[model samples]
Target chain A: MNRFGFFILFIIIIFSSKKLYSKNIKVCSTCEFKSLEMAIESSCNYDSIIVEKGIYKEFNIIISKPLTIFGKGTPTIDGNYRGEIFEITSENVTIEGFNIINVGESFKNDNAAIRIKNSKNVTIKNNFFENIFFGIYLEKSSFCKIYNNSVTGKATEELYSGNGIHLWHCKNILIENNIIKNVRDGIYLEFSNQCNVINNISQNNLRYGLHFMFSNDDTYRKNNFQNNGSGVAVMFSRNIEMLDNVFQENWGSASYGLLIKEINDSKITNNVFLKNTLGVNMEGSNRISFKGNDFIKNGWAIRVRGASYSNSIVKNNFINNTFDISYNGNINKNLLHKNYWSKYNGYDINKDGIGDLPHRPVSLFSYVVNKSPGAILLIRSLFALILDFSERAYPIFTPTYLIDNEPSINKSE
Target chain B: MIKILSYCFYDITRGYWISIYLSFYLFLGFGLLFLNNDISSAIITLMNIVIYLVPFISLIFGLTYYYSSREFTELLLVQPLKRKTIVLGQFLGVSICLSLSLVFGLSIPFFLVGAYNIENIFDLFVLIVLGCFLTFIFTSISYIISIMNDNKIRGLGYSILIWLFLSVIYDGFLMSFLIYFEQYPLEKISLAFVLLNPIDLARTLMILNLDISALLGYTGALYKIYFGTFNGIIVSSIILFIWLLAPVILMLRIFKKKDF
Candidate 1:
């Protein structure tokens, strides 16, 4: 043996003694392996199973160890057109570029296209889920990044359906850049904390585009919720920031662009509300800062009721709403400052951008809805004419404190 | 008749009729109840029932009327009865069937939930009936649409389009106007808009019943002074009647002009 052969022997020995080893396994739908579940079950550590591009009918593939499953060009793992396809129970798992579909609907079971239960640091990306019940559900999971995935479901009713991306009891999750449509909820967070949802488009969901319930310390930015039935609702949550999101085309008598209930210490800024029945319906919400929002072409810009205290509505553009602001209670603890009122006829003095006089937004018609239920028809009559003028003159029927003191002369971004 | 009855029965009894609405209404009722514990669940439940029942009954009945007019037209037209009788019969049949279903689905569950007193439930029952009447009003219009168009898809599409326009777009336009005229007195404008859309009137009725009208604010105050009493219910009924009557009469007039 020469010096060169001895050197090659030494290198091979060192490489073989490494901590981890990987193997690539190719599985096709036509293969005798029969299912993706079989292929996954048979795989081991440091294994990369590349699934072929076909609809492989399988269900409930549980991965209990570290693995990397890569699908080549959107290989679909359908639940035989029936149930949950993948349930991950391990840490350090990656499921990339797969189409998971037809998750089962059952009251007895919680089915998902990909359910990550009790897992951490799991990365699921670039997957497509079509007509699934629960797409990418994470229950009791933490520190997961679900990125660049699209989940679509046709949920007619709320009973037999689930959300596009549901995170329950999850924390420190980053769900970014996903497009979801026609599900019960596009993105749902329940009892979830510290999640970041960025740059997602959720449209036409049956119930809500994005629903957060008891989910605290979350920030959702640059998401578009359009034409959903009830729009987006953030309820029973606190310490949240919803920035630069567009909530539009959610129009129904009971619907609103954003419904905030029982929320405190949150910031809703730079949001666009268009063509919604109610732009923002705040109930029992306190200390919320709504700034620099654009309320365009909505029925009611802000409908405040019950314990909605100390909310600051500042630098918002109230453009083209039937009612700029409606306040039911006598107590107007909320503050409206420097908002651009399209209806404001007051002149700007001192070369400042603020209006010379405060804009009193509460209309007498809202007062009629409170005092008498039958006077809505007289809306067209001259009687409504005199009453509104009298109220505006006296400023008595409407809440005295519900005044936008520093209304902006021009709209702000 | 039996075939139609069977189809309607199957649609209703198979749990398909109210599932969509039930899910939403129940969720809304429970959610609101839990969120605002001070506000009675009865209020939420009543509002949910009214909101869900009115539109759903209208849509389903409208579609069913359209379907029957399209599907069994040959027999319907060739019958010995006048076109008015045939149209009215079909309209009433659908209305009755759907009203029955709404009553069964909502009233029984409402009683079970123990949300309201007998008087309020009775009042709700009357409101649901009125809602059914509103559904038939639209159904008759859909029937006219069916008669005018040879294509079922076009007819259905037109109905849905009109529904969307009235339900979504109209309110948006009104809101836009309100925002533009924010400095002006908008109480009268909102009331006028509500009168134009019977759904708005229906919603007002339900909300006032639940005492949630305060949520609408100063605009709501304008309405409350004018239309926020028991007399408002009477006005809503009148408006709903006009909404039902006008389209149906127009449909009847147009039906005579239609080739079918």
Candidate 2:
């Protein structure tokens, strides 16, 4: 017998021994193992428990073993206003196809429908969570997958509401295809690193749809955030890639489509911000690149407050925003390059789709309103128009260096 | 009064001036709509032009029409009509023709472009209605200026100055005042100043219907309190109506006691 032939037979024998050792356990009211807790306790490692179709009124179903729990007909686990339904502490546990409800309301401890603590390689998929304090709480966990779940919380007050999916000090989590509403924040990450959040719908949340604080290297793409208090807030974060998200209709004095505060080394590309009070309220954010985004019909698109430095705003379409680029001070440290402004009426005589003259985005009326907010009442007045025209002909009050160098004459890219 | 109003209406409509004015607005409306390619944005451009052009054209046309028809006005004054009837009837005749021409002209493009299905129809309605108010307000103001001054050049110059002040100079003064006294809480005071000018009031009314109202409320809670309610709209429109009435009543009184 050659060495390669023996190696293949040895691999087949090891796989056949694992299949021969692991067994399936049945869980139902009429079955031998009536309760899920008893079934989980009696099952051995690497065993699969198939739960039948019945209402199991249980709470604190702790999983400290490596077992895969699947529901045959999606059985209901009614917590009945009790504490945490599934507390996963061990690694390599999978929980799928169950309806969890009525997690006890504890504002201090945050009772979640499914709470995974200090566990790795946990997979939770295709679950329905209703009337819970927190939907999925991932703490100090790594390589966790939360997929295809729906979380609806009956939260009204900001203080009483918990987030739909809260991650604290976690790493390398994937949260995709989740629908969350009526929570404080749809998805919140605090100190969590390298998480990928994609294809989520978070709308009508009481606070921000997705909030990241001190979470680095997070990529969120193709998420729809609408009608929340604000769409997304990334504060004190770095190396974040936000791509192809749609933020719309978050309208208030304090609300913005995306609030980037104290963030650095991030890329925001190809997102559409529509009808927000202020789209991209940027403050103290440095070296961030904003490219190929659309700002449509917002009150203020990219209002740069103090200390936002070296940010290159390139190739974005600014269509019908009341003020395209509102800067508080006169020091222009950012680059405005090759953007399309609908208000740019400069001649494109060179016929390269770029205007012949540079376009000055901020008007004197916007500056006056910034100086004295009462002057906003004079918007669109003929006197304001005259002031803008004269300031254009004779530079004053507006930043002279803030010009779109290659302003597109038409709406292209 | 009705007979004199009808006679003046037929007399104005018989001239090519009314057709030319109507066609100018039609061409402007269609051009703006074509240029913007979006009905909502087209309404914004039309608002800017209407606020400036409606008053300027009304002031110029009102003064010129009044000056050119002085002999006809004297001929009607010697008839059995009361002075109140002659004055208000001729004023109503000019106001109605201008208002109808503006409203009808701007609306044709909207209907043709199917803007009536979108939500911008209400904004269009406000724009044209404010343009009408501007026509009435400025025509009455021009009548006051024409009646006060016997010299044609002085009246013409005075009308231009008033338009300049109301449309341009008044906002400049208000801006400088706000910037100068920016320390004080001037939301209410500045709102009161906006109410004083009919042109600014008309502009404010149009702005309230657009998304820019959210920006107006972004200053402070005081701006939101003042400019965020239906009562704010009602109050502004009432102030605009008062601007129309006050000058009109004064013009009637001055023309009644004039030595002509």
Candidate 3:
């Protein structure tokens, strides 16, 4: 009976102590924990800080513990253009259902709405960021998930604006379903590896919708990039898979749907490039595979510039672009096969879907325009057409081996 | 002038040649629509044929009609009509007949294809207007050529050469100029050269109206800034009008002092 009494006391003491720690700390204007900073300071590890629906006019709120910063009904954290709002310096942090706004703009430093530094397994979900210089910056972080967040900036110039989601030395990050716009580069990934950027709409930015530098083994699929200064630019990257993205209406003299420089062994498949000034401007890229893409109404589709070698361009639909392919050099080390060109007027006498004769994607007019851009004024002129026809009869100025061997008669759906 | 214009108009309208021209356009329009099936793309294809073929046909047809009607012209000269009225009337009559044929022929197929609801209706209207301008300009030039040289074969050769120069050879020289002086800034000079050639001017006008001007890159952007606005369009239209007026006035002046 004495032993049973001792056991009952032990169970009661354990339950009371467990409830004393790891409890919900509610913060509001009327609550005992009035401010978010006080609540975060007083709360122990593994505690949940519930912020109610009110505008918390505060900045520089640093969370250095493993805490769940939960919002009751999307509480507003107004930085008032002061500084960074929430800096997560701890691991296993999950901050959701918050409206973070008015992040301070700085030229020397990137002041983000939420800056995560040296963190692991941080999940930033369902947050709305506005008027921010930088949004959701991850520095030297890994295993972060930024999902369903809309990061918008009111930036007018490149020098003052920062990226919507900036990842530096990040790994295994998942960025999905985010609507990012009006920043310098919508999603700037530098030295970030094994990142999956999917289902994001990045449009109308001051610069490229997405920019990658020195990143490898990254995959960005099903993203919509439109009407920016340019579309996505991947430079000095390798093993990148850009699949099922829609790039549209990115038109300017120097704009491109996808610009790759010094990139090697990338696979770009099933993407739609529509109405861009130059779709796929490749320079010094090697062993890249372009398959099942639709190039529609672009200025110059796939301008293979200096030293782009061993590229297999196959199964893509070239529909009514001003120039199907523009090559700078005379050497042709790339392979183009089984592509449907709308300007192909050859016959299929063998009852097969492929044409009997090859389709030359590059014309002498494009070659001339490449040599002298002023010659583009004579496009669609009678002289240019006759020149293109005669050059086809004898391959003189254009790249001779840049021909689609099995040109498809019908467009692939 | 109105009586002379009416007589010339009715006479050309009754000719089998006008009907053949109308039927040829009808066949081309229908065949292009049937092949493309997309109204917007059909308009693009029509643009290619119309830019070159329209001027070619207008030039040759005006020369042939004038050469064949020399006796009729002499007969009209013996009447109480003035040379200015006769020259202007014949020019208006031939241009109007060819313009009507082009408009009606292309419009039927487009309307039947339900292109009235397409947003490219404005482009089609621009096309018809440009076609009329080409006809008027080429016909007046042909009239001036016929009046200058009394020999029919010489007149034919000169008119053909003029068409060839404006449509093809002028661009050849411009291209050579562009290639030879590629290091120089050729924007202003190319725009000036395009303004000089009526065929290239019409092509630039129509291409700028379409969204494909983005493909033209820097020169296209410069052209868009100069010719894609309301003021620029007005200036281009005025330029095309001057091209028409200069030849017509010259033809009238040459006929006024002719030794025939």
lDDT of each: 0.75, 0.89, 0.90
Estimate, for each residue in A88-123, the C-alpha lDDT of model 3 and write its tens digit. Answer: 999998998899999998777789999999999999
The segments of candidate 2 whose C-alpha lies over 4 angstroms from its true place after superposition are A1-19, A27-35, A53-57, A73-75, A80-83, A330-333, A340-342, A345-356, A404-413, B32-37, B230-234
Ten residues in sequence with the least summed lDDT for candidate 2 chain A: A324-333
Clashing pairs in 3: none
- Tell the DockQ for candidate 1: 0.02
lDDT of 2 by residue, A171-256 (tens): 99999999999899999999999999999999999999999999999999999999999999999999999999999999876789
Candidate 2: residue A69 lDDT (0-100): 94
| TM-score (all chains, Cα) for each model | 0.61, 0.91, 0.91
> What is model 1's native contact fraction?
0.00
Question: DockQ of each candidate's interface versus the true one?
Answer: 0.02, 0.57, 0.66
lDDT of 2 at A324: 84
Model 3: docking quality category: medium
Q: What TM-score does the predicted chain A of each candidate obtain versus native chain A?
A: 0.92, 0.94, 0.94
* Model 3 accuracy (lDDT, Cα): 0.90
